[model samples]
Target: MLITKGYFYNRESHVNCQALKDAWVTLLSRYHWDWFCTFTFRGEILHPEKASKTFDTLLCKINRALFGR
Candidate 1:
């Protein structure tokens, strides 16, 4: 929801590794915003090199959810 809401992708916003971690921390602490980190994020939006193993797992899950395989 964050990306669609225009939060994480803004060039004005610092969405680097450390900044992302901190934002997740804040969202976890706040509770309501957890969906931004967990659900709203799309690994396919990241470059291939930047997609981690975890993202691979998520991508597989997304594929399964969409394709029913």
Candidate 2:
């Protein structure tokens, strides 16, 4: 999937598999955060996690992992 702070992503986690296979989407921009960076795709946020994430939050977690908290 993708990570970003864009406020337009509203897909499911499992859908990424198909979304990738279909080539209907691709990582776009990156909302730079203190820790991680957000990845945007097709003007949408690509969090798609089971937890309550709004693309922005997912980006935070990604930051924590990649850049550390």
Candidate 2's C-alpha runs over 4 A off are 1-53
- The digit string of per-residue lDDT tens for model 2 on 1-69 reads 454443223465433445554453334233433655454457655556723456657769878999887
- Cα-based lDDT at residue 53, candidate 1: 61
RMSD of each: 11.7, 14.4
**TM-score of every candidate:** 0.27, 0.25
* Model 1 lDDT tens row, 1-69: 146432456556535556677877987796554344543345457655556766778889989999998
**Model 2: what TM-score?**
0.25
Each model's lDDT comes to 0.63, 0.53
Best by TM-score: 1
Candidate whose lDDT is highest: 1
